[model samples]
Target chain A: MKNRIVILGVLLALGFSAQAQKYFTRDARVQFNSDTPVEKIEAVNKSGTSVLDTQTGRMDWKVLIKNFLFEKALMQEHFNENYMESTKYPNATFKGSITNLQDVNFAKDGTYKVTAKGAMTIHGVEQEITVPGTLTVGGGAVKVKADFVVKPADYKIDIPGVVRDNIAKEIAVTIDASLKPMGK
Target chain B: MLKKIVLFLAVAGVIGAGIGYYMFNKKVPSMASEKSEVTIEAAQLYQEFEADEAAASAKYVGKIVAVSGTVLEASALEDGTPKVLLDTGSDFGVSCEFDPNTKHAKTTFTPGEKLTLKGECAGINLDVQLARCVVVQ
Candidate 1:
């Protein structure tokens, strides 16, 4: 009886460990919108990569700055040449963790609302941020969704006085990713 | 004579302003309509990126490139957008993001399929990224 109980405990530990593996996505969608009374500017990037470890509650995301596409060609050029300076800082990244890991059950197939805190770096500047998000685990996949706000001034992005009114100080950002098991 | 000089200056200024306005508003052509700036294999591009990212970016960034390679993976996004990944002998490879508006009906690129893609290089992270990709062959 003692040996059988020990074997059962080991099997349970292995099963739980397997569920703690990392999940990732190569094409995470990240969109940003700047809506002011005078103007509305927005861009979308679908080539962002993100990784999440369910056990450690850690997550990381990386996106190339040049991948953000705008509707207007001139706006795209101004974004890369004048504002974000994509040549100097080609990538934006976020490294953080899910603060509410205890509230999430990875094995369950349901949507869990959670908060994540991390440092987001853009244009060579890093800022600590906490964002509310949804994590859905279903069909052997993990999907994450989050909405947050970012300030251009915080990243030292300078807008010319002529176009200052055309852009907003705070930009609304949205992220959605459907991650697969690692090494898949 | 002064009046003629002022009139000439005013006319030149107006023409210049008009041209400036037109240029300012001009948008880049869609990738499907534009010509590829350069043609290279996916492996070569990946090698260059891995060798020196800055050098590779200087050569490929903002330019339309035509890359031919074998498709290692093809998947549709949650919103039904099609994406393809080419082999690069690394943990990560080149990911091509296609125009979501295009109809890819009945066309699926499975692994080990040969394809040529033209798009703008978006620089490298874990993989060399391309956007607005259109399949040529």
Candidate 2:
């Protein structure tokens, strides 16, 4: 009787895990480029965090403002202080899900076009956004790639008139991350 | 006298613009040359952040902090950026990303090895993150 109960417990645990597979990564590379006729600025943050639930299609992402590194130190300083206000609003986050979760099978190995709708909060302002991206599932890992444009004014990221020409109206952002199965 | 006054003002304006341009284009200073403002144990730093993140961020974030601990993991990103995790007696620890701008003397770290590193505190995300870290003895 004891042996039967132990076996049942093991089976139950396996079934639970197989049904609700989760993917996670702490080292997501998030890059953004702003190009204008007068100047071009780019920065990359390597410590972006993301979590995905395959069963529910729920996902969450967060990146620290202070982590973004720019080639020029002065630009970084101005971005954190004058624009992003790292001391006050330290993080940018996305909370949402893949709208068409059933379209692509997570068990399959292929590149699937997916649309994610979420609320992105930046500089302490929240905005609803829909993002289109490619999700490649293979070799027990998933690679997520997305390209999107963000308007600073929409998020209340004020750009002073003095440097208006130096910054782009729409900033191009790229997200590339490989998420591994939870618990190795 | 009017001609001389205008010429003097022009020279001063040109000098001011030159200095502004130089400062604007200046690169981030090397971490090796920077001094750590706060020196603490890795476990303590993590504990403080876990206790009160806002308080810890106000005290340590953006400051060059030196933390000493046993290395839990040493790894590199896809772009070859080195990162080290210090053990904090919990699930998470203090994470330090080696300075890409400053050449490091030793990048490879074995688990359980005691080390001290200093970098600007970039705030906590699961682990207390330190950016542009350099080995400090």
Candidate 3:
């Protein structure tokens, strides 16, 4: 009986530890740039959340639209109020899983290509996209970097003809994130 | 008559230039600075809070300051507490939690708006890993 109880306790502890292993970052930054006479605009989402599941190779990210910043304050306002309509559609989320999960060994230091395919919702439109990126695992940490293009129309973001050329039809997005162990 | 036409053209050009200047250079009236205020970059403020929430809270508590950043996420807590994430291009963000009873809390800001927030710095949340925030934007 004593041995059986000890085994049960060990199993419970393992389960708890596994649950705690899930890593997340709320400070993920996604930036986009367009070159028109070399004018650069940038925005950051401070409340972005990226979650990774080691056991299942699943990852998820969510961000709010009103969080993007442009050097010109007017541009920023128009983005949220007119372009993104963030008040109506406040949040964007990506639900995807890493395909090369098995290739990553978090305990070792190496770089691996990670393929994430999932539904991304922006501007109240959801589309399926596959994002391929590099993931570096080392020092008990994971870092991811990827760059991809997203069509505004694909996500139902309608830009009026008057300013259509001001914004790109296809916006290039870049993501570079690093994640540390959740707890000591 | 040709001279009159040229005069009208010149007047129209002047009017057009004036309109263009107003649109491009005129600052919004409501944006006028009310008082001398300290402006801190969003990234620096976020790092300060992340490095030590308690210490940051003590240093900035009850001080009126302005921070500018991109809105990362905004949502209501389980108990209907409104919260916003301010990202400064870093891995950690400052979470602004507003009082439910505040008038502005009913409706003001939303996600994705680059905002300059002026507020009294509250404490940080150790459990949720967030910098406790109030709103003065």
Candidate 4:
């Protein structure tokens, strides 16, 4: 009977580990807006990924810079060649823990305000940032929405004097992500 | 005095015309097609690669470019070709395929030398998502 109990315990442990709530999205959309009277430009990175660990309240995200597309082709080229230097610095990432993780109940359908504090790395510079976001959890799916600002000089991105007025010193970034259960 | 004034005005007009001609006819460096290609530092290039691999690779395609980064991994091709993997210090890294015939390919770069490579942007692998590269230098 003891051996059978031990076997049952092992199976229960495996089942709990398998059911650990982890969510991910490969198609997370991150957009950056730089508005100036000279040029109102918006760029979107369509191929970003965000991973959410419910058990630990840890969140990880990565986005490719080259994928960020602009409406004008010339502007796109200028962005890669001149501004972001896509060939030189290609990705941005965030790794942080959700401060209000316990407040979110993934099993229930509801909207919860979440505060995530983590290090955001961009243009080869890493900065610690706290971002507040709204998470919608329902039907085995999760959606995240957040907006924040980052300074260009902080990342060592030098805007040339000629077009410095056109690009803002602080860029506004918005994130809208949909995540699914890892195995699913 | 009227004649002198007319002469002065004509000379001024001639000088103005000459200056205009110089301005229009003299070679002004064209920002486009000038091939003012600058070798991007390896660390910077890697950062760009990490941001957007496909878009970054597409932007540099068919251009004379130079990039520097650390060597991540290097290996030999089945056809006796040598390949080098470079980490641009960014999330996006690239594998450079060198022509086996080149002497420099035999021995020029080592891992973590912050190598600056000059090459024609060959294009990228959209399928496997590898940084498609060919060595020019």
The DockQ figures for the candidates are 0.59, 0.68, 0.07, 0.03
Q: Candidates' lDDT values, in order?
A: 0.89, 0.92, 0.66, 0.68
lDDT of 4: 0.68
Global lDDT of model 2:
0.92
Which candidate comes out best when scored by DockQ?
2
Q: Between candidates 3 and 4, which one is better according to TM-score? A: 3
lDDT of 4 at B102: 35
Q: Model 4: runs farther than 4 Å from truth?
A: A1-19, B1-137
Error of 3 at A114 (Å): 0.8
Residues B1-137, model 3: lDDT tens digits: 99999999999999999987667544322221333145676678767767785576556543455677777767764345456677767645656654322345443456678766554343332212222244444
Q: Listing every candidate in turn, what is its Cα RMSD in Å to the true structure after a full C-alpha superposition?
A: 6.1, 4.9, 12.6, 13.9
Model 3 per-residue lDDT at A176: 72
What TM-score quantifies how close candidate 4 is to the native fold? 0.56
lDDT of 2 at A116: 95
- Clashes per candidate (backbone, < 3 Å): 0, 0, 10, 22
Q: How would you order the candidates by TM-score, starting with the best?
A: 2, 1, 3, 4
Per-residue C-alpha lDDT of model 4 across residues A51-127, encoded as one tens digit per residue = 88888888999876655655554666777778777666666889999998889888899999999999998888899
User: On a 0 to 1 DockQ scale, where is model 2?
Assistant: 0.68
User: What would the per-residue lDDT of candidate 2 be over residues B5-70, giving only the tens digit for each residue?
Assistant: 999999999999999998999988889999999999999999999999999999999999999999
lDDT per residue, candidate 1, A135-167, as tens digits? 999999999999998999999999999999999
Top-lDDT candidate index: 2
How well is each residue in B46-112 modelled by candidate 4, as lDDT tens digits?
5554568667566664455666666765655433445566675443455455432234534445666
